[model samples]
Target chain A: MRIVLVPGVPALLPSYASIEDPVADLRAACHHAVAELGPRVRVLASSPLGERVARHLLGAAGAEESEADPTGALVVANGSAKRTVKAPGHLDERAEAFDDDLRRALVQPLPAGLAGIDVDLAAELWADVGAMPALAELLTPGTTAEVDYDDAPYGVQYWVIRWS
Target chain B: MLELGRHTFADDATLMMAIVNRTPDSFYDKGATWAEDAAFERVAAVVEQGAEIVDIGGIKAAPGEEIGPAEEKARVVDFVARVREAYPDLAISVDTWRAEVGDAVCAAGADLLNDAWGGADPDLVDVAAAHGAAIVCTHTGGVTPRTRPFRIEYDDVVAAAIADTVAYAERALAAGVARESIVIDPAHDFGKHTFHSLELTRRLGEMVDTGWPVLVSLSNKDFVGEALGLPVGERLTGTLATTAICAWAGARIYRVHEVVETRQVVDMVATIAGRRPPQRAIRGLQ
Candidate 1:
């Protein structure tokens, strides 16, 4: 089974679109990763907003939203949004280290660090990791991640990763 | 869709028709662009400022010296050809009330005939139809060309405007002009006093409801100046304020001297009216 991850960036939705896209590269990477997740994909997200974003990405990728014997899973989550003074949540000294740890957790074949993330620290750093624990059950031991996109363009850490 | 000769625009599209006066006695610019080179430069400036059309006029709307058809053609025909050749993609409009000058400009590659004199010339629509060009049919309470309103009174000004302009639009349609190529205007300050103009501005939606695209030439006219008690050069604020009101009322085209400011006002009003999306909204969504 294939599993893909995309950030729950509001700018990626049609309602928040601009004449010139602010997250062009990130959106393209999300579409690319989501398209690789076959027709029947189940969406997993922490909150309602995250689920909406995940579903929008799935629709944009021409994938069917199915929970009955799904072929793949789409996870919606992102790291710290407080990486700089210009960030949405403003500057937090712990944001860089927290995002670094999240980046490390995303690339590992097992992602043990993601499953064991401290919820309090993640909240303080303005990181969204509620959907990460589901990846631990979906990805098997030998499954490896192909990091398609990784950036902090808007002072928010977003990654587009595909696992199989 | 609005089929303006060589160009077609979506129904919801708002267009800016920048004024390019080729005469020496126009009210706003005076003689700023009277010379051919100066007029061409004006076209370039407005085009850079994102104007969709240029309304070139040979004679000032307010009466001064009597300009015959020969002089009017001399002023606008070659200039229209020059502009058409230079800006092949731009929608070229000639502001004239005479069918003779309209024919000459249309033959010179003008895309639209802006009859600001309220169709005093009966054959203007035929000229527009013959050239496959668009026409702006305006209401002037049946006033003669180059004349001002002294004591004109209408029982229902808005109703009169809607009826007259719609009838003119139907006349154009019956004269072989394409359905999408006809537009209506309630020629503000042409034959109406300040009170009449204000009433027209306040209830412009009735004209919009006629299912004809409405064009408003409200740039630094006497009505706005008289409303605010300001001079011609200081009427931008009042003009934009009135423009916002008209835009909210669904006016499609704006003929103006200040393109950039008017465009911004129209866009902002359209956005507020829910007809247009914000240009780049990331304030809280980021």
Candidate 2:
């Protein structure tokens, strides 16, 4: 039941506006979910910078540095979100370009055993709402483990990989 | 969608009919028996297990011991009335070839007339037509000898079975029975050997091709017993296997003993065939 939320490109603006610091918001969500759900909770943030920020937040939460290993990490990104905000006039071409960029981002090299990547902001937003843990379980080396998304109202596409 | 009594058969799924024999010498459950309470329990159990129809037979119809029309009608009428009273929504089918029994059962709330004699008795067809109830015409040809002597004579078994069943269908239709209300059964294990049953099942798709649903009753029959060398009690697995094969070959209705298990197997087969998988909810973030 551990959940990791990755902010969609569109929701990132509102998220940063509320928290003023995107990294701090991600870390607080993870720590809160873990404290609420007990020790089983492990929240992960997507992106190399996001991962570094998550580790720092864990230390600030009074969690031992040794207890917070690289194994619990997730990289979240939204491929479709880029297409949503692309130039409205040339929608099809811009959407295609956005998709290519998202695919490039997904296929890029990352730390070994990274947990699943979240492709949308809604999943990441769930962490702030105390719904899911910040860290996501890795289904495969580069795949996100299946999570209970029945409560998710609209379809949000996301991906995850194993935490190195 | 076609409606039989309160039950509906729209899409092609194996409609299960549990056998309920009131006679003392039924082929499968001869020694193990029922009267009033037992019959009621069996009816409830089968219906709970997803049986759309419960076929009750008064006469043994095993090999010998054929009762007169009056006796058969009396037994059928009384049994159908009791069952109908117990399960008002149940689709009760009286298994008899006597026209008198058909009439009595219809009047007593039976929804379908199951003629094992293949409508040989014109009066039976007339009764079914008069009541506007569905008819299950099974191929039970020739006289039932003392022990059912083996007979293997036919230019083409599949063609002959189809032609004979089609002829019966025509007769029932001509007798005023609606075409949709008629269901044809190849009558496995009734005056037919194992090979005959096998051939009938193999060509069962032809029955479906006739533009009507086919009901194949291979539940714990002699063929399955002989094939698996198991007793009647142990033939459920084999019967389920044959039911699966027949379903793949396009038999729409299955008369089975283990209704729930048979339903699962048929559902799995249907799933693999991509007809419809188990219901699942798709989830994602808004």
Candidate 3:
């Protein structure tokens, strides 16, 4: 039962302009997740800096940009810490599309050998996590469980997906 | 080969009957009327996605497109023969109400009959009964939308639909078709509106209660599109959602276009529901 955690990060944040180093914050979050999940962890990300941060933490050896290997784990994190923000009007659809795009970009890149992938949702966006179970069922199709990450200001929602 | 009455399916995986339109005016795949190789490629891709059955049809049972019985038989036979040769063990189901087409395809090694008319033609029933072929009885009032309105007046839609299917089953049985030779499909978008389709899906437990396997054909249907506001090409997510719900409701068969994706959805739902064992161990791991 190898586990992978993929956390969704809200990139559009009020703090993005003020923060001196977003990369440092992302690296800290990755370290926090690895330390919590233990030493045996592999993280998947779309951002080059995030991938670099993950490689530094997970000993980036033979890490490829594909999800063909099913032995590793995936963890996705959304960057926003505290905000119940709803996209205005049809922007909800765009949010959904963004969420979907992010999910596909992360999961599709995973190696098929990874046993299961888990998603960590932004705590502030819990209300926006509707129909995630169905989406997880479609994309991952294994043992799925939602976890609460209370460390972040907004409690993050985590979906743990085991391989079918 | 696993025998369903006289019909034989070589694969053990659940069959996915891809909708092949012979009519030149189908709502989604209308231009597919003359693309035999493309149709065959679709079948191959579906098979790669774990579909064990392929259903071929000549007439578009939609609003205004209807082909004659002779043309229907010719088209179906030609397609089935070509598919059978390409994939010998593939279970080919002929979608037609005419007996001649059913008879011709069954002779061409086609394994099943998917009749939307529910054995309305005696010759079709006779052909199925004579050959021991598996028959999928779907509820379509008639070929034309005018004859079969989108909204049907029934005392209890679920009960009436089940009863109608049972009655069709009885007729097929009386016509010498074996009991196991028949499967029931609620006919999700054929003359039924979105509400009706959802009602049928919600009450799918009742259909499974009939002591027969149920084939759910909600893949890329109009009701799904209406519910999710997605077009046919973009409806994969919604279609997978419906497939998951139906599998949860205990539908043994699913007729879908996205075979690999649908198979994964059904497998996951089945695993979660405990209907089947998990592919990997979930307990006693160190």
Q: Which parts of model 2 are misplaced by more than 4 Å?
A: A1-164, B5-7, B143-149, B281-286
Q: Predicted candidate 1: interface RMSD?
A: 1.6
- Candidate 2 lDDT, tens digit per residue, A65-151? 233543233234433322232222212324344334433333443213123333243222222211122232233344433321111
How much lDDT does each candidate structure score?
0.91, 0.61, 0.61
Among these predictions, the greatest TM-score belongs to: 1
RMSD of each: 1.1, 16.6, 16.7
lDDT of 3 at A116: 36
Worst 10 residues of 3 chain B by lDDT: B277-286
- Taking all chains together, each candidate's TM-score versus the true structure is 0.98, 0.64, 0.60
Estimate, for each residue in B1-286, the C-alpha lDDT of model 2 and write its tens digit.
5455445677665677888877667777773444655766888899888888898877775666767877676556787888888887777887877787788889898888877767667787788888888888777555442246377566776777778788888888899988778888888877678878888877778877887678888989888998889987888888988888888877777777778998888877876676644333121211
Looking at model 2 chain B, report the run of 10 residues with the lowest lDDT sum.
B277-286
Error of 1 at A59 (Å): 1.8
Superior by TM-score: candidate 1 or candidate 3: 1
Tell me how candidate 3 scores on lDDT. Answer: 0.61
Expressed as tens digits, the lDDT of each residue in B225-274 for candidate 1 is 99999998999999999999999999999999999999999999988888
Ranking by TM-score: 1, 2, 3
Model 3 segments more than 4 A misplaced: A1-164, B5-13, B141-151, B282-284
State the lDDT of candidate 3 residue by residue for A1-164, as single tens digits: 24444344332122222224333344354444444433444455555544544455455333333344434454444422222232212122233333444344334533331223223432233322322332343345444433323222222222233332
